[model samples]
Target: QMATETRTHGDYTVGWICASSIERRAAMAMLDELHEPLPTPEYDRNIYTLGSIGKHNVVIACPPMGTAAPYIISMTNIFRAINFSLLVGVGSGIPPDVRLGDVVVGTLEGHNPKEMMLNPLVEAENSVHVETWAATPPQPLLEALKKIKTEYELSGSRIPEYLERLKRDSPALASRYLKSDSLQDLLFDADYGHVTPDFANLSFIPREENDCRFCDKTMTVKRKPREMRVHYGLIASADREIKSAPLRDRLCRNFGGKVLCIDMDIARIKILFPSHYPCLVVRGICDYADSHKNMEWRDHAAIMAAAYAKDLLHEQDLQILEWLTPVDYGPRHRDFLRRWQPETGLWLLDSAEYKTWLSTKKQTLFCPGDIGSGKTILTSAVINDVKTRFQINPVVGIAYIYCDHRHKETQQIDELIASILKQLTQKLFSLPDCIRQMYEKHKYGQTRPSLNEILGVLHTIIGEYSRVFIIVDALDECPTSSGCRQTFLKELSNLQNQFGVNCFATSRLDPDIIAQFRTNSISLEIRENAKDVQLYVKRYMEQLPAFTELDQWQQETMLVKVLEHVDKRYDLA
Candidate 1:
């Protein structure tokens, strides 16, 4: 005991409560060697040592073996009651990959049954339906373990949790090392060897060292300084042990590309906090399931891993890496508002049109009126609102697309046709049935369309149920070939009869354009000369402080005159 006491230790003591008396004694001996004591209490069979790690103090306790479920439940239930960081699991390892002397770290868990059984977070383009599962590891902690493993030799073990069990109630649940290939043969009929669907399917990305914003190019990395370093990686927590290729293949593929480590319970952890918490999985590879298996790395692996964790905690470089604490894992819950990346053409939209879009789902109805009217802006606003407002089965996007004609004048019937068709081809991902049928029948780009030919094409493209609103401004500014203006009128008439989409256009009120849609359409001419002139005058006067642009009496006179002019003609909205 005196020799043990002479061994210097951290201010805190650590040990598993499920560890037997002999294991506990070794734990105490280690603590004594480090100048720490095993104050982990013996309550029931659970072990907890009371001590200090830095300024914070708590009993580092362990529940029954393979008992993280109970241990975590109890730990969290009293999380407000305890001062420790977490309930870290310590267990056996599969030899060589995780030999008797090697130290290993357990960070993540895979609870497969819960994931495969639940139909959550399913949407288009994972491209197909794949089984789901939960993955967990607090990322920061898992990353710390990885850096530690690199400088020090480590070992891994499957069912190290079972080792905890052998210490307690059952000797039947084997804690011995077993290769993944031989894992099934070893535990074929062994007690509690059932495979629990693992939380292996979730998409987990690890923290990269050099995260640069300017490029998607791979980063060159180097270590920086920090304190309390945490390790992260892929973590799997399965109920029944998994040793098959299908399961291994899925995990191997994800981990091969992902910052792979192991952890347990992201889904449950996500549920634990309704807010956004990125999933991090880090686990010790317990066995060399691959052809090259080693059998000497187990016991010391965890200890070595723990040493790295300690080194990181004390290292001067800890603070430099603090920025890794926050990562933007876009909305995990479907009910929450989704954010759109700029590249996806979904930037942001907040407008009245957004409100109308959600409540009515109305696609057509252009913001009619002349130039400077907020038509496109209003459309963008509506699409943005749709992103936030509809929580369940959310609308993909409110597409705000515009066509800039090369002609630069008014929208011609042919130019308009060309622009609309181009937008459809460029933007819409799927070809509608009518469009597909029409394309199969006609050869495209043979030549530009005549006015009547354009109308025939428009009818096929814009079908019923889903209406695409066309906003064409300045019809009067449009230059036409000869007297095609009359023919343009005929095309407009055909659009309404066949497609039934509402058309919103602005123009100089040419007698021909007006007369064309004169039937079965709504039109009102804007007296731009009236409101714009008054607005310009009012805005100029308001720019001066204390009505200083003009005398207070003069301001009153001007304000009244502007109000009268504004209220007299035209509608705004």
Candidate 2:
């Protein structure tokens, strides 16, 4: 262990320890870009090194890309398995019997056969051999397969691919790629598999090598009596990396008789040197042909083919989501504020107090303002203010209080709760991963959120998403019992004091509602803020294109006249 040398890299140092690997070489290449290769010791004949990733140093060491050595070991969250900063098992598929052409879409069981009965050629070959080697997939794996299939079914028709989209917009990719009937067929899920753009090079495997008895019989691999194409999981190894599509798939299909991903020796590496090592696979679609026969797919072509493959199958589903990330797209909450273009926090309402009240982050306030006072417009402004000021990017949200004047009591409370839930969901439309994970943990959306649950969601938004803001218009119109109103107000006060989220309410100033808030919660009268009202009215008029032509004096004069003229008698509402 002492014989090994070490050197400084960022905060950490690079050195060679006893542990060694093919992946070590690839990792070194990447690490080397920052600096020269540093050597250390062969503690257990292992490869170890320390290099700076940024300011901090990373101790990266791997056995190899293709050997039966652990492909990776990462203690930190930020990891890269050769461009797969994130790798997930979308799931697996069977092979051979299931001719998996590039871009082909099928269910888990589509590649599996319930029974297997081969011709006489296989019958004479080895009944005992088939019985011994034929695969009976694990029931759990099968069940997972079924679930994936069901998910696909629920998704309905696929979204159009970039190629189809480009054709509509420019007609250029269509002209070039659409030339081939095989290519033209790639428009949608035209077939089981969307042929990858790249052609496969089957030269690596001897054409005769694919011959079989009961199934594809290379040497060790014995296919089931009834064959189906399925992508099997396997490990890979390399002195560096075996990125060649033909090589990877060929070795996997020919040698291991399994589906191929990036890391060639993960299974072997795990077995030989066990650890929760990460491995990544990124394959280009070189060919879709079942036979060794070749077509137009080549290296660059294969790259495109793979790109298209993801587009057709996985990427299509992810396209909508791509814009969802905060990185790719700016915060939607901010976007809403920018779009609304509110000048100040006040939402236009008959009562000045309620107008200012709307600024609260979360509340189901009753708007006591007179009718036609622009309550809805004012409420929208309140929500917009929170969104802009706090820079809260809500993933789910909506802004409104639906009122069925037809039924204000029992039906109204239920409706109010439902309405709030809907808006909350919109603000949380794209729930934070933590919130989503937690919600999924508790089965939230599956059931209406309890008051506590709703509060919890607000907390999550405050924690993970951003500052919470809610605008509920005209709760007074809701015909629920005074107690129900009190409960709702109580919850709001609790939320406000607890989470610092504000709620703004507009109502007709019902004495019962007022008494409820005063007794059970911190209540504020909303009818009297005349200055804020005047400002809002003026601001609203100022937005008119012609307002720019008017001088400041004219603006004030117009606002005062409108404010004084509008009927504010409490008896009318």
Candidate 3:
């Protein structure tokens, strides 16, 4: 049974890019739950399937043009929240190591940085129009790749199991997606050309049969039957298909014999998208890049790649909720993060002061803004950015607090300090001895630890990590009536001064809060940028009841008028 949920565009985190309907269908089959389609912009020509594979909300898109243009349009229009992308499909395999139906993930074997780039193929004195270099994929995906590969080494592949499940669920596609017989999986020698039997007569122009039935079976190369497996190495991609064996060999030689598979059109992604757009290519070998290639294994190959991707996502899902702590700000953090507009608040990330704060130890950054200045949303962006950057590093800890006046009673100084300890300990396998001892010391008496005791335990936990980031949003909301705010700020300063912890805080221009950081911290005033203001106004206008009734000019005029009013009042610069 397929469960359907209503989700917004920002909810999706993974972009599964496909070139053909077969690959699209393969991607859809792997979804655990299908989400209701959200409205897209008129300019985006690509169609998307929104669904979830494990914990990941994956947006699978098949471009109309099968090029980079449509994919870029779609990203700009609909996939604003996509963290990274995966290019999944079937491709022609490089021989000697890879066989038909085996999966190839685009990653270097070891630490060789040279494999990061693939030189363009020169055929007939012309260079192929494709991306010459590719950036590294996101760290989480790389970590998942390592985990899945380790699992494969220990227990073989789970791809066969997923394929069997798909066959059981979709009867119509079962026949097409079924594995081809080993006998039909044929490879011809590179020098052996598929030519007409009547070679003596020039009248014979081409081979007749699509299959190799009419060709000389004796020319087929013999290979031992092996289980379908996954390979990891460099992938060579081009603008066009490689149907010629000599061209494929030349391309492989150009890459120093490191090309594991050759795929068409994937290069467009790297060529068009920036390096920050993280992507990983996963290809299933459909045929050896030779004249004997046919559609016999393409369907099987597509499903094989899709099955591996699903398993990879399943592994990724496991890592997300592997730990639970007593106090978790994850819910609050997620709520604030959901309000973030894509591509907004990037100026703060690019600012020199913010960079210095991140690069230096024991640094504090204070951001003060007026009310309705999108301070909370920008803070959420910073938290999300920092977490994404250091997600794969076990020695880094991120703890955040979303202070609210309504919850001030529960968000006292001791509780707030302990929350940091709670979050950081979740990153470790077990609690530090001091924390466990403190808990035991107070458990029987139902007594709460003092602020200093909690801070002492926090100090112990902070030492476990190479670096720790403390982010507090809406710090002005921390209750000042009972001295909670002052105590909390003092504890944060003590941690930064004593333990080299990095602290990031956002509050209104409260004189007391500003006084604490004015001397020793990098301070930045949070102001709404013109672009972000325009985006916010446009999104709000789109939700109005009369928005659709207006013509294009009128709608644009309304947007311009609203932005002008905002600029006049706030001086968005």
Output the number of the lDDT-best candidate. 3
Candidate 3 residue-wise lDDT, 1-573, digit = tens: 455556788888888888888899888887877888888878777878888876678899888866644565566557688888888999889988999989998876653433233233344544454323445788998899998898688546557656665676787887778774543777888878765345423454342235566678788889998888899887776776667677778777767787788887556665566656688889988999887787778888988999888888776643422321245577676777777776778889999999999999999999999887888888889998998787546678889999998987668877788778777865553335576577668767867777778777778889988899999999999988778899889888888888899999999999988998889999999976777777767876788989878999999988887776664222222
Superposed model 2: Cα runs more than 4 Å off: 1-367, 391-467, 481-483, 516-573
Would you list the C-alpha lDDT of every candidate in the order shown?
A: 0.35, 0.37, 0.77
Q: How do these models rank on TM-score, best leading?
A: 3, 2, 1
TM-score for candidate 1: 0.28
TM-score for each model: 0.28, 0.32, 0.53
Name the runs in model 1 displaced over 4 angstroms: 1-412, 424-457, 512-514, 528-533, 541-573
lDDT of 2 at 55: 19
Better of 1 and 2 by TM-score: 2
Looking at candidate 1, the ten consecutive residues that score lowest on lDDT are 324-333
Score residue 413 of candidate 1 by CA lDDT.
50
The best-first sequence of candidates by lDDT reads 3, 2, 1
Q: Write the per-residue lDDT of candidate 2 for residues 119-156, one digit (tens) a residue.
A: 22223332110100112333433443344344335432
Clashes of 1: 90
lDDT of 1 by residue, 437-541 (tens): 443344354333354554554555554225444444445555556544455545545554565444455454456666655655544434334434455456555
